[model samples]
Target: MLDTQGRNEPDTLNSDTPEQDLPALDIPKHERRVQTVIQDLPVETLCGRISRGALILQPEFQRNFVWNSTKASRLIESLLLNIPIPVVYVAEAAGGKQDVVDGQQRLTSISAFVAGTFPGPSGQKRDFKLSGLQVLNELNGKRFSDLDSATQNLILEATLRVIVIKAESHPDVKFEVFERLNLGAEKLNDQELRNCVYRGRYNTLLAQISQYKPFLDIQGLSAPHNRMADRQLILRFFALQRLTHLHYRGNMKQVMNRELEDHRDPSDAALKHLEELFTRSIDMAWAVFGPRAFRRYQPGTATQPDGMWEERLNFALWDTLLYTFSFYQKSDIIPNADRIYEEFLDVMTYDATFAEYVTSTGDKADRVRYRADTWRRRMDAVVGPPRSDSRTFSRKLKKALFEADSSCAICSQQIQTLDDAEVDHIVHYWRGGQTIPENARLTHRYCNRARGGRED
Candidate 1:
């Protein structure tokens, strides 16, 4: 039977093969150093550590505190009744600090009660009061302070079982533990788990770029507050960029995890380049398609306009467009923006073959490559083919325009500003010219127009 997350639960093993007939399952000794210790600590001790910041209840990896006062009260009631609670998983960081990987809601509720505050409807901190207690009806609507000393001591002295994954354990092992433990109850989304597993420069960069205004505007998101969905989209762009050739053979989650692991500690220069690349691509998309950047466009209907676009964001379209813009030059992209936008709409409307790539489950590596390649080819038909050395030309153009203040090659006049300049092929495209920096020059738009597709 499928679980809540749609994953199938394992069936009972009814194998007839003897143990000697089974194949050996081997794991490298060096990779098996996962050390975990179980301890039962008093609730007062855990709360004191949280208050002192020694126990990190809320790490960047954890979701926001979402437990309501009623739920908190239920947990408190359970504790007071001496019921067996689930063991919480914690990872030991350096210098004796502990990060609570699982059981955040339970721990946070405990901490909040100890601190005498609970978040109200408006998210303001208010006095913590237990309510909606069915078994413990007498204790309903009572705050911790209102409890008798014996009852308070019962809560404070309650021991919670914690599974501590030691600092010396492999990081991947810890991530696996976190993932397996939380897969059923209070499960984290894939990106949330990724944020915890891949905590480094690249992860930080993805979080930063996901909040860029153009990205937020295109996704119709006001803020990066939706379960890290925007951040996940940003991560998809980078991951698919790396796996564009469809080399990966696993699921989408595996692809994302591998990509994050590969880029966990990217250099500052690389991070800055990625930031610029994503920002420029997003800006270009905004300039071309406006609010309909990633939305699917339906052709005119009897009741709808000539181009009826869906308000909901389409991830398939987003990934295809992001891959296209991310891998192509902005100068090349800007010239055919209108055509690209129109053709994308037409492709979505008329091309049934392309539709399957996006409409169905497109997480397969081949599907990803197919959709990206199909859209890329369509865009190329409008923008001209991307050169193998296009990145070199892009860097050169930036240096020429921004660093050197280069002038127009056609008119031999100073190109005063970026808005006034355009990077052009010194040898026109129709005349067998390559789109390389050596064959390119910064020219005023009017000057470039003055050339008028001339071979010379």
Candidate 2:
């Protein structure tokens, strides 16, 4: 039986072995306090464990195997030519269990290469053929091969060394451990981390919404921009059941994961409310058009004389925004959902697409292009500026320095303004500091000249 308090205590469940007794378990109750040990493990055994699902990728765990074709092929070369791989890190779990805490990418890459699958940034590339230590590839259908044999043998002998830790049994414990261990490494964002933790009903819902054609097709949404949006969408659609303005930060993932972990199954009441809202939103999107297809909204100022495409697409955009708002609500439908929905509809109908002109394909096409371009430009406009308001440069600079924790690159002292500081070039203007963000750094007025006005 599971503990009502959800504690992994001895009284919670029955165990056939005394070794399985909760008290006998020497691991720490909280994962954050746990220490890791490095161990050498065989690649074959690791793959076997992963395939059997005995190895659980804690919900907050990240799957970042950044190896491209060349790197992947080298892994195969080492293996085939009989080289040693490095040590692998495995986190010790309860009941004498262990999991790959690090080296997931290396292990995964080795598996992929052996299985004859190599993935790139876009998709799988079948063109990779391992020749000694080098990877031969036909780019644009032209052939290029990897480095030579002694290198191949050297690669193969690479040892697999891993830093292993004991994973805490509970989700909360695991989350805390994940947070601490992932620092300075490529850490998963809150949502992604949340997704890692609660790989249950809520996670499925999130994945569904992420890939949902209507939602995913919306513009200005991509992996980086959508991280927060994705979590917000799931929360609003299922948890809140209504549209909510997104604050975009906070421990949203942790809060939501706790809620889901508590609820073993989807609540009927919540699901019914969500389904109704979903149907209503979708129906309303097309209701303005007619019994047939929906029309695009176009303002009077639009270049097109008359068309419906603009309104249709705007409806789609609004729908996308509304979906995000709904998900942002996080598990309970909000009272303001209807108001938000209506307000967005109004924006789509009037501000975005006025009825003065009919929005056809060409008109809708142009509006979509304009909106995409405009939104990007608007976002970029203030991105470099520190303050949200752009008219005041000094205010913007101050905000950037303070909010971003920016400091003089050379002195490593924080800078607040032009009065005491100035921008210095890493490469002299004669050598090309070029006045770009990368080459420029905040410096004291005297330091700027002393260091040749360079960041370095």
Best by lDDT: 1
Q: lDDT of each prediction vs. the true structure?
A: 0.72, 0.43
lDDT of 2 at 198: 50
Highest TM-score scorer:
1
Estimate candidate 1's alpha-carbon lDDT, on a 0 to 1 scale.
0.72
* Runs with alpha carbons beyond 4 Å of true place in candidate 1: 1-35, 92-96, 119-124, 129-153, 165-187, 200-203, 265-268, 297-310, 345-352, 385-456
Model 2 lowest lDDT segment of ten:
11-20
Candidate 2 overall lDDT versus native: 0.43
Q: Candidate 1 residues 17-115, lDDT tens each?
A: 223433322235696667889999999999999989899987666677888899999999999999987888888864688888888889999878878
- Worst lDDT run of 10 residues, candidate 1, spans 8-17
On a 0 to 100 scale, what is the lDDT of residue 390 in model 1? 32
- Residues 208-261 of candidate 2 have per-residue lDDT tens digits of 445543333332233322333444344533432221223222232333455656
